[model samples]
Target: MPRAYEEIADERQHGRDTHVRRPRARVVRDSGRHQWEKDRARRPPAVRAATGATERDTGLLPDDLVFSARYRTIEAPGELAEAFGVCEGTALLERSYRTRYAAETAPFSLVTSYLPHALAAANPDLLDVSREPWPGGTHHQLSTVGIEIDRVEERVSARPPTPQETRELELPAGTAVILVRKTSYDTRGRIVDVSDVVLPGDRTELFFTTRLERW
Candidate 1:
């Protein structure tokens, strides 16, 4: 649910203030399939322009990606706990996102990222959604705290979205959704963050590049 609606529902359930405002959803659009492709070795000049590149580094120069993030802190869920290698009672900072293209109202994808409180405690800003779009993205943010992400593991799968997902992503009947679960690991092999991304099957694509060693 949108954060605003969730707040309103909570208030109503407790017979509290009924004047709660509903939060608006943010949409992000993709220019082409370029953003989905993995090409770190051949990054465009824009990426090199900054010591730390953000959404703008993806070749959307002049036009930046627009989005909103709803954040919360909660006990780590079972699956999240396993991914983080922590006990179930650990606290986690969750940032839920909806991104849209310039001037567009519908979202291109839905994303949620979870950060272990223990690891993220160094930077108070990471716990707050209001601080997001994080200038240089998570990499720069983590670097500030002496943690370097050396490996990123992305697992992709496709399946039918739930009814709620269907409504949120505005998918049509029989449409499948592409799910990408990305886990970031530090040099010490500690999981720093895990992000779940949902892409509209009709408008999303993925690409990979590999170089084989000659024997």
Candidate 2:
């Protein structure tokens, strides 16, 4: 059966809105670095375009920002305890960072990281938030204590942002957020660190590539 005219119009408007404003085009690829490579000269890929007359600015996050991180000790939550194979009340270092953009009202992604206190206690600097954006990111931090991250697994999910997330992210109504739970393991097959990251869906893209063994 032919679609109703009103429903067709609504669908068309939604398509146009995404194409013209929020393209979600950034290819969020992993370069195998715990931190992004400093490539200030790289321009973000272009947004989906219409004719030259209709092309508009891309919805990209700011390139400059104020960085802040808070660190504290807490008992491991049950799920984390199970994943780390530690006692239910094992102490863990909880670190959270809050970023304020130079040009935008909304903040960027939210991330919370957890590490076993026993492991990090070996390096006093790991407990200090002041040392962050810490020279080489997580993998480097772990190295200072003889822990080498051998592999990482990330699980991605999405759902509408919570009321608090909407306000903090300054998201427009009906927008969603992407959630990534990343687990890092050392050569011993022990889960060494875990991070939960929340990304705003309006401006982010997820990408991955795989190589195959020679047949």
Candidate 3:
């Protein structure tokens, strides 16, 4: 009986030792860094590229103004002012026009603006109209022209086109209008001019080209 009791006590001790030596369950607290890393990894690479540097570093070009006069006669002076969002009486000078072959069948129109003709002409370098690299924005271009741009006022309106405008300008379906008004000032603190631009969104593709030079 004594030997049996001793053997039973030794068995119980071995069982207790085995339980103590077994691995405990570990609880890892979440810190949220793993989830954040996962979310960042899922975003598009272009978003990361654009956010990584300034315009100069990324070699992006300035905005190009694209105009189409396919269906209209020469735009009137007042109409030009209305289109550009400038004040009334701002003169509209026809800078240049060319008939270019887009594809074999579709021949599109091209029009360029000498913006300084309406406003006061600054120095040559200030009004350089060549295809040089520039930042992509209207305000940025106006800044290069020596015009003190205050703010951009946008107005969108749609109306049935007049018989003449519709026939000449070639109105299409869903042909509403977009007007961007740019208010600028001169060195004398006087409101120099306001420019408004009208665009037919379907046919016009504004091309902005920028080339970055080596440091």
lDDT per residue, candidate 3, 76-166, as tens digits?
Answer: 4665555556666654333332222111112122223334343424434323435222222233344555554433333444455455434
lDDT score of residue 145 within candidate 1: 81
Give the alpha carbon lDDT tens digit for every residue of 1-215 in model 1: 44564565567678786542343333233322223222321345455333222243233332434668898889997999999999997999888887664433457688888987766778887777787655546666676688777778888899998988888877767889999898988899999989998987865656566557999
- The segments of candidate 2 whose C-alpha lies over 4 angstroms from its true place after superposition are 1-63
**Highest TM-score, which number?**
2
Assess candidate 1 and give its TM-score to the true structure: 0.72
Query: How many residue pairs clash in all the candidates, one count each?
Result: 7, 0, 13
Judging by lDDT, tell me the better candidate of 2 and 3.
2
The ten-residue window of minimal lDDT in model 3 covers 21-30
Model 3 segments beyond 4 Å from truth?
A: 1-120, 136-138, 145-147, 161-174, 180-182, 185-189, 199-215
RMSD over all Cα atoms, model 2: 11.1
